[model samples]
Target: MPSSGSYAMVLDSTFSTERRACRFSRILIDGGSSINILYRDTMEKLGIKQGQLQPSRTVFHGIVPGLSCSPIGKVKIDVMFGDKNHFHREPIWFEVVDLDSPYHALLGRPALAKFMEVPHYAYLKMKMPGPKGIITIAGDYQKSLTCAAASSQLDESLFIAEEKRLLDRVVAMASKQSDMPTDPKSAETQGSFQAAKETKKIALDQADPKRFAVVGSHLDNR
Candidate 1:
């Protein structure tokens, strides 16, 4: 194994459906995160829809400070880890988000606690007790980095595309507004008006005279 701090490796692995029919890869094991997250794209890959999600009002932070994220909903699904020989299966609750991310899913503290697993970050491995024996899983560093790099690049490109779309929308709106027929007649008032004996401005704030209210001589102090 490489010496500690020699290299940084993110623990990315795979989780399969209860029956082992489908597998979702590139799942990050984040012990620091308090909640399990399932991205919308993966949720779709799971063949589920937003309408099928159970309602949840819970909000979480730790993304951008001062900003809280509310999940699309919460879902409990049976997931299994490890090979067929020795593995652990359990129902895990995940909060689904519509946002795009580098990984398909994030297995957080909740999953760690449930599985009673210990993860070694430097080695990029996780160990948990199984019914048969101890299951030690390790992720490929090269693949993990490759996936992250590709995902991040795709994310950036998507942002640029969305920015262009927004600019086009704004330009289209401006063109539509310009196309609308307008009468220049509205700017000029039809009749002349006169005010009764005018009075000086009454400064309400002692500090700044600019912040004042006008009181006409015709009106009472009240």
Candidate 2:
């Protein structure tokens, strides 16, 4: 299971369906509720009117599903949600509710029940009660460390390539300094050649590391 940090998401408090975007720190996930809830203040900022709400219900608010969260007053636009690859580009439906205090929105069970069903480390304290049973969940940022594992290999490769390229540049510059003539014309030529060699080495480092390393290892290689 991924840690809470792995799934830690930041929501914009002042988001626009069209223009004038803003972000908020108040975002919560609630498995107990059936529908996602939005605060009146946020809705107003987005230029969404209460009249647009669809007839739906929870203890605090009514449902406005399928219509999409759009900014109507300023410009025609859509509010988007989700992560890099797995995101809901379609305007997500939100219900307008009169929130007393403490939260801007609640991500109800329906919005993230599936992902929650999987085992996960917690970042905060939360509870859930459903047809099967009731479960109390703890939240923590620990899972974020595991997420790093997913990209560890890629990071390692990039680091190695970068390191090798830098090392090759250092070596080439050192060699050029040692081999260059004191004569002005020949010194300029050597410096230019040295710069070109460094550029080629960096490019080769990105495309084919082994070849770059082999060539950098010998005079005949470049």
Candidate 3:
């Protein structure tokens, strides 16, 4: 087993869009991902116009099985790293997705390859070749933990919202059924009404478990 200090660290960095500079507290430099991704909200906040986005067919899959996300579009933005003297700038293509993550963006394998950088997670740093020399980016352990917690909370909220939406739909359907006229004296009408109630209950029970499973799987992957 590794020592406590030897744990892997989450790396973060500051980047700017065309409009303004932004500091992303939660950036996951993932070597596993083939392409870099930017959250839709972040792109919008950076004043990127919807017309600038080009349609894309790229799909993103999480660690969870059967869970996949599709990007809304793709855009090219200039990304800069390092301090005043040693900073490097490059135009990077990013897939914009509607992801409710704590991270504003994810720098993936492509970005890593572009920078020709090697990440040393144990040391909480990454180094890349620069014009002058090697440039180093450090990770913050405390900030990573805080961001992880916040991301978890956000996931929970989204799950709850989805559940509430399903429940509301079910309730609406029941209310519509109740509004329909039914002759209480007719035995056939009574039987049909009772059957409808049972059907509604069964539908609610079955649909809820599936939806909950999907949400749980997505959360587990994150």
Report, for every candidate in turn, its global Cα lDDT versus the true structure: 0.74, 0.48, 0.73
Residue 12 of model 2, lDDT score: 28
Q: Which portions of model 3 miss their true places by more than 4 Å?
A: 1-12, 17-20, 63-67, 167-222
Give me the overall lDDT of model 1: 0.74
TM-score of each: 0.64, 0.35, 0.67
RMSD of each: 9.1, 22.8, 18.0
Off by over 4 Å in 2: 1-15, 57-90, 113-121, 124-222
Give the worst 10-residue stretch by lDDT in candidate 1.
186-195
- The segments of candidate 1 whose C-alpha lies over 4 angstroms from its true place after superposition are 1-20, 62-68, 151-222
How many clashes show up per model? 0, 13, 0
For residues 1-222, what per-residue lDDT tens digits would candidate 2 score against the true structure? 443334542232234565355554555555556766666777777666667656653344222211134222221224334333333323345666553324456566655554343323344444334344544444434433343343355456655766799999999999999875889888777673643343234235566766543233224433
lDDT value, candidate 3, whole model: 0.73
Model 3 agreement with the true structure over 49-104: per-residue lDDT tens digits: 77889999997786223357888899887776687889766777999887777778
Q: Alpha-carbon error at 96 in model 1, in Å?
A: 0.3
From the highest TM-score down, the ranking of the candidates is 3, 1, 2
